[model samples]
Target: MTHPPSAHDAPWWRHAVIYQVYPRSFADATGDGVGDLPGITSRLPYLAGLGVDAVWISPFYRSPMADAGYDVADYRDVDPVFGTLEDADALLQRAHDLGIRVIVDLVPNHTSDEHAWFEQALAAAPGSAERERYVFRDGRGDGSEPPNNWKSIFGGIAWTRVIEPDGTPGQWYLHLFDSKQPDLNWRNPEVVEEFHDILRFWLDRGVDGFRVDVAHSLVKDAALPDWEARAVMAGADDEPVVHGDLGPMWDQEEVHEIYRGWREVLDSYNPEGDPQRDRILCAEAWLPTQERTMAYVRPDEMHQAFNFHYLQAPWRAADQQRIVETSLEAAEAVGAPTTWVLSNHDVVRHASRLGLPVGQPRPNGIAAGDPQPNAVLGLRRARAATAMMLALPGSAYLYNGEELGLPDHTALPAHVRADPAFHRTQGEETGRDGCRVPMPWVAGEPSFGFGAPDDVDTWLPQPLLYGSLSADRQEGVAGSTLELYRTLLRLRREHDLGVGGLEWLTALEGMPLPEGVVAFTNAREDGPVVTVLTNFGEVPVVLPEGREVLVASGRLHRDGDGRRTLHQDCTVWLG
Candidate 1:
């Protein structure tokens, strides 16, 4: 997965702009009020128009609808709710025909409680091979207590005691997530062999790659030692805990061996002798430090890990600058490209997030009664932040609807929420359903054109304000968020910004620039130089001379002398 130094030799993912589609919320072609693979196929044109190089579809595997498909009941088949396996094949073909690669989400850490293996484990006696496939263990103390002090990532105890087939309280199984998802025993030889076959099954179906879900959780401390007693984090996107402070259940050392095996499976596909043809494995590893993050992207392991450090950084000038510098440096150390992202299905959208007063702790979810963010200011900063993110030197990921400046459905009611985090925490946490609402494609249409025009149903309710921000309303509109994204993506490709070299313009020929302005220049070998300037302060500032304005998040103000001034919360690209 090494990215060649020269842009010509680099793998497509090194500079690709990949878009994520949460299938259940992407589109509803079946009119079942839920999205499906066929819906994604029908929307390929929209993605092509959005200018992303690839599409990363979230889990649509056979499941019981617990944790929204993260709990896999079958690895080799598509869930009926998301259409059939045939529909998935059609999506792959259509995306490739449009010059787009498809990266399917792979959940290997755990399986649904109803999965065949788990059911078999329930029927088998304790200490049997069937039960050994999962993390099943005897209860502690009086056989009523959990095996360890660990808490589930969603909430509650990490271990769920299962009733034996003989009708007695039996072994407790580990489920770092919801009780419905039982963690696999990766150390088991049979479990390892099963995942290898799963990888080959999808690769044979022509998927370009996989976004490994919970990539760091496959392996755990063999000792199964009790962790320090601590409260479970409300949501999964909390800031990374340092290695020494981390619990034994996450980011274990043995995980690297598993990925190294998966890498071999990917390399086997490059029969054309071109490393670029090898399928990619992008890890969803929320690790401690930059160095630990880089380890996942080394040549023998994953091609990229989500740059969560950048995603979680505060919307401050100094913090963003430092994160960008450290992210680039850390990835460079391993000869891998940095993968930048703003918002995803797991966290609050950056629009509403950055709109909050600076330095306020990011909430798990924003409900109808929660203090709201200023929509105008939020969209402005979201656009500016996205522009800056695209100008950086690495691959970038765009969650669906982000190009439309969509904010969280902050007013969504608790009754309609389906995220496991929300229910597990007894509604104290708002959960991620707000960020997973069906996208609004057409203005003034039923379900905002998410389904048939007459169909008023959606899996999750939409907000009334979605009408004005629908894709149809923003397309072709000047200075609209959708158009700005199209422009930014276009310029990024034309300037080779994804594979370019970046350096901070800390000072022009040793002269300092304005405070609260983060500026940098990106130049690829044998490519044009593009400068990006973002103003995060309250004041406007003049741009450097001899650079022509290419695009901006907002309108540039003109001073009395006719010089263009970059205003607050604006980001501009100069050529």
Candidate 2:
């Protein structure tokens, strides 16, 4: 897709560079040991200067914090721990003033057990309208067994039996995630209409768009049949990538129907008179295939879906190339731009992931006694991988601290962990708290300047390594990851890489890339050509003649002929 001559001439989201902010760990302004809205607002200048086009803040709505704000109790109000409605309004105003858009997280699939609606459902008798708003069903045989044999993504059975107000055993409600997060019944008209109103409430508050949480989950199979015999998506090592159905719990066909209505709600805000002011929706879909993932971004539905396929790809040239090709092809067919992401709050940082031995199972949580990744190799590969990611022909998402080359706090004490994944699994599987440690803004300040100097403690302890890698220490330091990102983002926009067409180096007749190299050229119809190459092999590869180097992820070696040689785990942008 060709970019319009000016940002105002096209939808900003089409080629935007978004940054994901995990709030509780971003900054703490209230000195309460937790990151708050005012804290995020205070950091808007840092984001604006970072050159990102928008920020997708994780859920900060009123909640019991059972699942780190994912179990939203009130969709319209900000959690007191974070801030209030006035603080949210101020954040929106300040971010917009800085030319940065805001995309708030929306958890529509479930509501907290403490939510007013859920409380009402608990008090009302079974089969009442209040109970109908959720997936409350009578259990089979003495009402003791779960309604279905569905497993929660967290752990255990997906259904949770609730005790009635009269102290009698009642119906079981579907949770899909943590027990405290009751899944909403989308089939109920009140549930559907309530979300429609929730969308308008935020849109009217001036949010540019929403990052829909569990976009594929609002609707499930009507039958809710047992899934033990159904087909499941397997990993790359598995023989066939995808076959049969995705079971009754995920990627149901009815989800698209729900999103189409949301599109109408967003479109209502963007009349012909204000096309550039269009509101967009992004899906956090973790499907098994490009075909399934692309369905969420169809023209009349959501605008973009997370590319988990790319995020989960092994650090191999062939694998990366295949995913990029398929993703681009699939999105192009549906008139949507592909989204690229390397790190986020839910998984181990890509820096640490790349450092681990190839093909090892990704760890949910790492402690002191566990196998450790190679910090040096991990950061090197991470920088190279990021350069290649930013140069791809679409939007790129940067996690909060990946810019600082931050690795996971693998040795964090178990007692301080808060991720529901950890508690739900009873410590057998560590949770995502390793990667959610608070960012270090200063090298010497308490909590690394996360809050006031006297705020000695944070919600999650910072790793000792954060001292040297702090943003203050990295600033103005040449070759630092932070500086590399600033330069990469600047040139990406300057060359219009996001809106350019991508062609594999091998696709160009007579140009065969090295065996272990992934190379591509991106050029807009009216913009200069830019080439990105990454060396994943052990041997150095000689560069082609007469290409000017714009940026390099690491130091390059020069041969006798003065030609640049890209070393292993190195990436370079040539123009």
Candidate 3:
């Protein structure tokens, strides 16, 4: 028998399956061809049906859309393009009524250059109090070059030289990302106070939590330093190695202090109140190691941090096992639960990323000139990988459209690309537009039913083949990726797999398994033991004798000797 979720016992967030909703691409209810708060509110019933415990909405704040909503122009208001403040309240209320919590993005590291404070700083004289809210420093040479040699994550120099009101060259401002996004000076008390107020604004309106964007990047090293050669050449043009000694820009020690303060603010919401209603905070931190990642989720700090290392691990049994072990160990040390994620709006979709060679660094975007991804192989592996992730003893995050097994649209026309990386790299790096295409909802409809009316044009064009992968096409279809996800979620909750203890099972009794297979058992105190087996090799492996099969990612073959066989890139849950 399955027990109802009780937060007073373990809290909803500890083992919740949170679905990430990229507001622009999730669903467009208005005829405007853009997703809005009302659009998301209308879809709460769907998410509730999907069995997700919460919804983590991406940034929908007022912005210039320079970095696709990461550059915030205003913190307290919703973007007019997405919807108004009233719509946000409605989304929150509807989600709560459906027993799903809501977590909105909180981007504190930077703000859009068009923001009132940024505009005032530009008009004010150098070294003025207005400029102190942001990182402003004098150039190294004749004040023409940048102060330091730091490079922006997008491309080009991290510093942008500012022209004085008197028409003379002045100090430069720092922007870790697009130039339009000026990095805030976290050292400033006013900046800290402003974010605190912003957090309360949403918390007061009944938001469940905040997904802190670039959580590790809030505090920079006091002394700016140049990037070392090894660090500069770490990844592709668009992929910056923010992990491992990225000096003066990311993973600074002071960032922990900031989150500790934010933790106090979150705790204030549930003072002597029900633990079930306690507001939570999750970090989008990209630390170097699992141990380092756990620092953000210490008992007194944030509740969870994204497991990027697990997502980037190669599709090998050993690699996956090592990451899982380290992640669980580190999270356990802090008394916090681990968060497993496959894909998000920023990176190439997992379907395409998994199809590439195992060890090579994956690019953020794939261009038309690039080699094509093997969609069939990618989808098979993705389905198996997600099954394994959901059975693990922690929370799992599902990006929008992953349930439909959507691959990145690599053939997108160059003219429609909007990612700043594409513009900065001059098309050398296609950017992340391929993964951010509007999600398909209905088959054989214009824009694939991403928006209302056949004539409405989505913000980003949908691929011609999207109709086949539409949610409408996959719904209720056996063996479909969507159905597989729904089944796995149902089983996960029924067996308490999300909060159960995990034990690696290499061989049953005396039977030895294949070399490239991963097997583990999700053993709950009271529920039946669910053994998960995944095959990464070419040849099919025989399933252990006498074990009853519960579910499988692909078709299974039965041997005459009464043994069940699992095909390559397939996963199964057995009792």
Candidate 4:
């Protein structure tokens, strides 16, 4: 499964503008109140027009609806809620036709208890081959004692007992997530073989690649030691301990074998030798520095690991620039490509994260005790964020509805929320469902056509930005946010800044940024490149030097000092 040296020379993941879509909430072709593969196909052209190179559809595989679709019942089949295999095939064909690559979410860490493999493991006698499918051990002081001092990623003990038909206390199995999702025993030869075959199945079906869920969790600390690395258990707010890193043994000469072997499978699919016909492996590694993150992207491993520094970066202009510069320097130091994500299904929106108000909050999204965002300021800030996202180096991840300035609004009742970790932990840390709301394509209509075009009531009932911000309403508006996004994307494609080939120059400051302005440049091997200056302060600020002004949010004009001054909350590019 090897591609030609020339065709596979450059990594496709390097320059792509990737769009992440929660398929079930994207669009519903069957009017079944959920988005499906057919729905995705119908929307393919829209994504293509937006200029994204790849689409990462989150877990549409067969699942039990626990943790949304992360708990897989069958890795090979598309969940009926998301349509059948035929629908997926149609989507892949349509996207490829539009020149958009497709990548599906792969959760190899664990499978649903309902899966045949797990069920078999529960039924088998202790120490049997079937029992070995998962980490099944006796309770209490027996070999089971959880194998370590680990706590579940969801909170509480990581071990739970399984029962046989005869009421015997079957051995307990390890589950870093839900009690129903038993951890696969990577220590077992059979488990690794199972996943390798799963990889081949999709590659053969023509998927461009995969976003490996918990890529580092495929294997755990073989020693199964007690709590290590503090208590990273169950995310922030500190729950109990669970899951461990894939150690030297897991990174074992064997893990590389998995990726190298998988690459072979991907190249085999590109029989015609298309230059861009290849697989992309993205790992969700949120390491502190670029060097740590790049390890996942080097040659044979993940093509792109998650970059979280920007998301965690302070709103202060200098801080944000430093994060980007540090990351760029680190990647270059190791010669690895990076990926960028502004919003995802897990975190709060940029506007919310920045504490800005997001256009009058709906009564539904405002939790009983939460403060409502300053609606107007929120939208303005998000638009500005969009500008920054488009201009960044490497692949840009656009979550659904972000193009339309959509505000996060899923207001889950304390009881109905489904995220396992959120419930298991004490902060009642709102899990992802808050961000995976239905895409409101129609405005003001019943249920906003998110559920069914004809019905107003949807599983996720909130006002659809139809008349105000719906696709139908903003499709042709020249200056609408969606249009701005489209324009920005088109402009991004016209420059190598969106691509990965250019050298990125650090905006080293010899002096503090002039009161309200943030300035930086993208250096190119060909010549001096564009200098991007942005003003977020309350007053207009002037650059100390003069250059050709390319684009401006406020007025792009020269100052008395022969420098360019931009209005507050505006941007200017020197070409």
Best candidate per lDDT, number?
1
Q: Which stretches of candidate 3 lie over 4 Å from their true place?
A: 1-8, 229-243, 560-562
lDDT tens digits, residues 1-575, model 4? 10011111355666678899988788878876778888888889989988888899999999897778889999999988888998888899999999999999998778988889888776677888987878776666754455555566566777887767578666778887778788888778888778878988888788988988766565666666565433241223232223434222123234445666556666667778665766778877544346656766666566677777666666566666667777666665555555667778777665455444322222212343577565556666666666765666667788888787776663557665556766776534556565667787767664455657564334454443334767777887775778877867776666556542333232323435555456655433443465666666765565545455544433455666666556655565566
Local accuracy of candidate 1 as per-residue lDDT tens digits, 307-383:
98888788889999998988988998998999899999988898888888887777888998899988888999999
Q: Given candidate 2, what's the lDDT at residue 385?
A: 95
lDDT (0-100) at residue 565 of candidate 4? 58
On the 0 to 100 scale, the lDDT of residue 252 in model 1 is: 80
Please give, for residues 227-291, the per-residue lDDT of candidate 3 as tens digits. Answer: 75322322243345554555667778888888888989999999986768879999987766788
Error of 1 at 530 (Å): 0.5
Clash list (residue pairs), candidate 1: none
Model 4: lowest-lDDT 10 consecutive positions:
1-10
The candidate that achieves the highest TM-score relative to the unseen native structure:
1
TM-score of 2: 0.95
Q: Which candidate, 1 or 2, has the higher lDDT?
A: 1
* Model 1: CA > 4 A from native: 1-6, 229-244, 452-456, 508-511, 544-546
Clashing pairs for predicted structure model 2, backbone only: none
Span of 10 residues, lowest total lDDT, candidate 3: 229-238
Model 1 error, position 446 (Å): 0.8
Q: Report lDDT (CA) for all predictions.
A: 0.87, 0.86, 0.86, 0.67
Q: Where is the poorest 10-residue window by lDDT in model 2?
A: 230-239
